[model samples]
Target chain A: MSAATPPSAVGPPAPGDAGVLVIDCVLVTEILTGFVREEVGKVGFRRGVVGLSGGVDSALTLAIACRALGAENVVPIVMPYRTSSPASERDARRVAAQLGADPLVIDISAQVDAYFERLPDADRARRGNKMARERMSILYDVSSARHALVIGTSNKTELLLGYSTIHGDSAYALNPIGDLYKTQVYALAGHLGLPEEVLAKAPSADLWEGQSDEEELGFSYALVDRLLFHMVDERRGRDELLRLGFDGGFVDQVARRVRDSQFKRRPPLIAKLSQRTIDRDFRYPRDWGR
Target chain B: MLSDPDVLAELAGEARPDPVVALAQGAPRLGDVPANVDRHLELIAQAAERGADLVVFPELSLTGYFLKDLVADSAVRLEGKEISALARASRAVDCVVGCILEGDDHRLHNAAVYLSRGEVVHVHRKVYLPTYGLFDEARYLAAGDRFRAFTMPLPSARAHREWRAGILICEDLWHPTSPAVLARDGVDVVICPSASPGRGVGSGAELGTAQSYDVMTRTYAQLLTTYVVYCNRVGYEDGVGFWGGSRVVGPDGEIRGEPASREEAMPLHRLERGALRRARIANPMLRDERHDVVDAEMRRLRRRSRM
Candidate 1:
């Protein structure tokens, strides 16, 4: 009511600074399944295929795929490198058995090793990226063979940080679990009735011996999920993030990576010399055929 | 079987004691006419079987909300198959459906169709087309120029007479003019079918949309002394998610009934005409509104600007 106070001083509505979004798991499951069904159906694909990695993300993705396009319509492909843990293969089989999902196992060691023989000086990161691409190639080949759409397994945390190899684990026809953070992934995995063995284990890509994703990223998924929830979803600013007690270094690094990985999430840019460039003006939805 | 006892009090003496309006909160496929029409028919039959005399669907109920150029593809004539299907279904229960309407002059309006007993009774084209935030209604569809209440003729002998009902799309009710106009005209019920998305978490309610809408609709009901029925869509389209918390707010601004959160539901509530009468008598907001003074002031402002 004071004349000195300006009316235009008000800002936009404050973002929801609520703690980690405790999801309605049932609704989320229904939505994910519906998304899968709707997305696949729109493209006229009757079946879904996922590269099962024996991790929580792929497991959740597989469960959703089964519910969406019946168990019979989903093809779980377990493509493992020669150095992959035996427990991973066993766990994949267990999940396949649990869901009545008939899985197709392909040993990708021969194919990857044959290619790497030409380049012997490849490091851990290089080998890891190569392995990811090799697995993705096998998934695509299986998809073609079985006439199924490849379901992506990367979560929002890995996605924001560009943790996965592009056109490798990231290449897919559609994804059911990409929106979920790693912590939420664990929660949903628990809700979906995955064994404690899987949930209790340190999260890894099975890239190298004892290669945990948390170790590589240098932060626990729980902390990162919490931080990302505030910084991105809630749109809290840098000052607020630090005020909320997040480490400045981690927040800065995550912000940089999310900015850097923008290209990974979008279509490749086309030089616009014509009146109708593909992404410029002649844009159509991915499911435009429907 | 939970019901509002205040509305039940009207059973003894009021002209229409219980007006059953079904809030059909469904996430319609984007730009799919025939399929959405079929889905509407299914919901109508379900609601009618549950004894709802009226069912209101979300804005752009036949076509999803975020259509840009696809609005052209989704546009349907009032004489088309979708309307025919809706009309046939209205034989069971009155239906309010949102769609892109192609007019005689080839103009299109984002409109709400009121179907009653196998006939298209009224079409209230959206008056205010929002162009902010996630909305681009002004850019895509032609904005309609008028706002008016239609009539609802119930079957009972005493309730057979036409009841004045105003229709507003998503953003129209946000403005004061539409509701004020309808309130002055003594509209008994205001049906708002919205595709409002879920946003914010701890801004007092589950969603920022829900909190703001709750305040808006409840305040409007109190001001207008009319039954406010809000039917919102659920499910994600492209990326945006609509939170479905469809409900009926009494003229007292108290929520009578609501469906479960973020799910497909057809929530039914009985609107009490006696309660509206009492609220109107109690508040008299509409009766006290000085439209003449407002009109004179507008003219004077215009004259001053011109001079």
Candidate 2:
């Protein structure tokens, strides 16, 4: 399709169809790999460290980083809790092997359990949040040890819905696939020819036993990706979305999630008092000359 | 100048060869004027060695785009050493380079200067300051107020006739009036230096931004009947990638040559005056343009708007 053709003229993708979200993966791969290399190299780092969850997002990120900084320069760290799915680890290892990267496995069971033992009544959500932060801590520590920048794996679908923990899985030195949606991530993974096991598995954070992202969110990625592509990227109004045959309640819920999660997408707000406050009046790009 | 019957009669019998021009697609270091000057000098030398009569660099070739607060520190005066170096390098080959110019009134402007034979011939400040959507040029720099064309002397030994040229920095070319004014002024060529960011990655092989530019440049070349030279930058600046597919389009609206996207390159193409003459003779759009009608209508519109 030509870039000039608007989504409305082409007709919005159906609720369960994400064909419009399919991108030219070859062009996207070239752009993203160049982004990783230049952004990381400017900061004086030649290597990248990524936390692998055996999920499609992280696997694609590792593959792009390997292509950007070479396979030997990218380190895939797999951190799993005691109750985490064993198949996740196996798939992550398989992905690493296919990409010619050695996997470094670190179990967070002891540290997480020791902390939760104090609050024995804590629920699964609390434990999951702690585990995410703990994994982030280990990745940063490994980044310092190996002198590599920490690369993030959060996709646009999760980021807009605030599904991932802020400053935990969301924090990184640079992200190769942050702009891509979950559906597009799968497309790019297929283009890059990732491991078949990783591609075939169900999407999950592996935070707790029997945890599935779609099941917990009460909606499939295909449905929400189509909705967000219109509501967010195309700037469609609520009434316009309803006219296009989207569920009213589902639309409101997704809109609220995006509105409430605006804080997660930005730096901490600073009150304006001085003449030139940081990120306010005194603005500079992050890649300013050193 | 071509409108003068005496000049037209004098040029009817003389033979002039096409002038070879080079488009230098470079990635300047952010806020580093001295380093970028060195890079431009090297490219100018290379273009001269390759038998190019002129070389044009991308917008803000002396300092990278997205300067924001760095604009104050990176702004250079016309008398500064950086421009002086470029002026000296132009002695070997005429060059058009971009920089943040600090005017005598202490205001900075996004400016592109045409240098020839150790002297600055013309300085064109970008009149359109795009402030919306990923651009904040108006916040840090002052806007220019006019579009004017100047005579450009060709470096070809066989061609003694000077070509009337105009420089439109990136956003300036987007407004149709900017190029229309230059076309009315009898410009034979329009040179644009751009720092266009790649965006809208859909199902197409080319970037959406690139497609828009291709359509716009081709339309302008065909309508105005002038050679269009577009030189865009490449590489990343704060995660914004500048897609460099620099090319030269003839007066017939055909792309002569273009470089690969997202890479630094220098592609050369000769601008044939014979093609320009043939296109203008066949179309006669410029000769038949009614400027008096446009001027009267603009004044009437202004009066109505005020009322």
Q: Go through the candidates in order and give each one's C-alpha lDDT.
A: 0.80, 0.89
lDDT of 2 at B245: 89
**What is the TM-score of candidate 1?**
0.81
Per residue, candidate 2 scores C-alpha lDDT tens digits across B30-123 of 9988889999999999999998888999999999999999999999888889999999999888899999999889999999999988889999
Q: Summarize candidate 1's per-residue lDDT along A202-261 as a digit string, tens digits.
A: 899998887888878887887778788888887889877766666677789889989999
In every candidate, how many clashes are there?
Answer: 0, 0
lDDT of 2 at B252: 86
Identify the CAPRI category of the predicted complex in candidate 2.
medium
Candidate 2 displacement at residue A285 in angstroms: 1.0
**Candidates' chain A TM-scores:** 0.92, 0.93
Q: Which segments of candidate 2 are over 4 A away from where they belong?
A: A1-19, B1-16, B156-158
Q: Supply the global lDDT for candidate 2.
A: 0.89
